[model samples]
Target: MTNKKIAVVISSIFIFIMVISCSTSNDNPSETPVIPAVLNTVGLIRNDAGALNDGYVLFAPIGSNTTYLIDKCGKQVKTWASSYKPGQSCYLLSDGSLLRPGNTNNTTFNAGGKGGIIEKIDWNGNVTWSYTISDALQCQHHDVKALPNGNILVIAWESKTNTEAIAQGRNPNLVPTTVWSEQIIEIKPTGTSGGTIVWEWHLWDHLVQDFDASKANFNTVASSSKLININYNASATNQDWIHLNSIDYNASLDQILVSSHSFNEVWIIDHSTTTAQAKSHAGGNSGNGGDLLYRWGNSLAYNTGTTTQLFGQHNAYWIESGFPFENQIMIFNNGNGRTGGNYSTIEIIKPPVSGYNYTQTLPYLPATTSWNYNYGNPNSLYAQNISGAQQLSNGNVLFCNGPAGIFTEINSSGTTVWQYINPVSTSGVLKQGVTAAQNSVFRSTFYPKTYSGFTGHTLISGSTIEDVNLISTSCK
Candidate 1:
């Protein structure tokens, strides 16, 4: 009832409330900062018992003008120079010639993944042949593969008009500019800088649409759901619907395996058909012509949405026929938006084939992957884009976690035997002390020491990244 008594009581209540608030804050202290996955060094991290494939690693940076062939120790054995920035893919031929895609200035098609040129240079760094594929209608982009008969298989974007896409049942409001579908073209190089189209396959011809009954490809997805949906990237008009990233040829089966990154599937098409026959569904050795002989990964794209298989995967290909895990399909399963979190996985599946078509149930399909590599910790090992995996001869797998700039090899039992961080850094990737982002490689492929591609060329000894000495003649 006194003034002093009232003031003391108010002071006590204020102090008690402040103390409880501070305790609650302490109890929920900010979570520990999670370390990101990045690599800043080059050379061996752990060469447990040595490398499985004793040879060279060939890779080109995403924004560079040079491609290097380096030994297992990361020593550059050879180099190929070009006038254009490197594309996402490159390769070396058995005759010591290099095949690579290069970027060119573009003003026509406003899209991503722009590589307008492809060049072939000999081991001596001479431009043997070059060809330009970028145009108003389409442009070469991500990947390329050299065929056995001296032709190159290139992936490009074929433009679709706004009116045309809307006619195909795409939402007009969702279309910003125009739609770009994917295409595969086989080009035979001619004099110096020209090529002739020997064979081609377009995705536009093999699409399925159910949104419009009056459209050319109209059909209920539930009735006949084999073609790709025409309305995938419904938001951005400049977006690519079917971004095809990697391409591989199966010589024994005369088929082609292509990775459609945007759609999350790998398509196998017969390469044994004539150019005219490839436009239809009835002519190749498999009797399917340009139609997909086999398709696997995401069924939701085809309307069989029971279970999702791949999450924006990349680089799906068949293992080399004679390798230890030969004939099995492999993928750089960039497990984005997965149940747990973002982590990359290597999925190898022996497709159940009964003749030409894939053999599997409608909803459950294939049932399981033959083998895979997700290394318990998926978050730290995730690379959402631009990566690959290869099954080696000694039953080991070599893969590039592109985003982290790390290349690793693991045995059949999921044990890491060899590891290397890319030491070479691109223009903006150089950090003060961190080695996690020194450099990034889209893919790194291994070559045997005795591979005929290196037969006569003398490999030099120097730093992991060195200048080439092309004084000697090439293997050819």
Candidate 2:
């Protein structure tokens, strides 16, 4: 053969081999995508407004196994390493321990926010206590609250069969083979990995379905929001009926506030009730047992009216005492499914609780919000899901735009005093607008400068602020 012909043949062979190798690599399901470290932050320190409360923010990226504690200047002061990725939430306790919900290999329900394991890790990243509360029937998910009595409050799904749901007036077509309703269980740790289910409240226990009058719990839900409408979310076959995302306890009021994403409402239930009383309609401080003593945000959830109060809200909790708002409620209104498109708002409202039931005549509280913060720009402040709002001791509000990975602190007058864009990106290739979708954080919480969690630890900032690439993003 001629030398030129031989050289051409060799080149063809090499190109063929390269194509085959590339194709094989692309077909491998085990190949992990290289996550990029993209820092997008203005880190603008605007203490001039006096809204800047010197504190540390803690959060874990949705799929990342490591949780971070960063200072106001956007520096990683501390971190906790975990073997399993945090399913959704992580909280730093006052005694230097971290209470975190994590995902397990178990695939019982395979639903969103299915966190099977709750672990208590110390300051040095050692697992001090761990509990597994998931099984084929039910599993913990989303948010967990640390109670005052050392017991932990967890949110789980109570699985119901199609027949069971139909019996409760659920439309058969909407009821898949299995349906999941929200439940709250207060667990008292008896051992390292096991706990006693000290107190429990199930959404299934308090339901009213006008769909089938023949079924049990059938009622014409008039003014009472206590009975959940089983057919309210029957558009699709998805069984996550009431996707309860957050749970907050008011120790003074002895009530538990839960935020339901699917229902677009926040319900206040009496925490002072016994387990048996909670399952019944009468027997608590408010004489409403496990039933919702007060509900707001979405009035249509009850038969009251069709006024859209809160459009898929989150992090509904009571403000601490001594603050200006004091006993008012603070919430992150994830303004999804709104008339004007996607926009978010931070709102504070005063609930009129004469006793167990809400005394307000209006469908929802506050003919107008007592105070609120919206960027004025429709798309300025929006997170479709997994965001939160916290009221700081200094009367400032810390808002977490979870999907956007942006955390901001704003003054009472709605002035942004500080801002930080999370630098971590799930996709190695950081596209400007889609970074939020790729890399999301469930929530970010602020701890005061004097938080006891930092007592014994030597804190140092291991993070550097990098200029963020601004993205023109729109919300659905």
Report the CA-based lDDT of candidate 1 relative to the real structure.
Answer: 0.74
Q: What tens digits encode model 1's per-residue C-alpha lDDT throughout 1-476?
A: 79999999999999776544432312322322111122213444445553564688888876567887866544567878898877778887899888888888666754545789999899999998988887888889878999889899999988888887888777667775778878889998899998899899888777767777778788766444446677654565456778888899988887889988777788888888897778887887877767777678877777776666787888898888788668989999888766567778898888777666665366425668888887455436788788899888888989998877678888887777777666556663233234445377788888888888887988774544522211111110
How big is the positional error of residue 103 in model 2, measured in Å on the Cα after superposition?
1.8
Q: How displaced is residue 295 in candidate 2, in Å?
A: 0.6
lDDT of the candidates, in the order given = 0.74, 0.77
**Which candidate number maximizes lDDT?**
2
Among all windows of 10 consecutive residues in model 2, the one with the lowest summed lDDT is 467-476
Worst lDDT 10-window in candidate 1: 467-476
lDDT of 2 by residue, 315-397 (tens): 88898898869888999999898667788888888888775567747475656778888836543777888889888877888
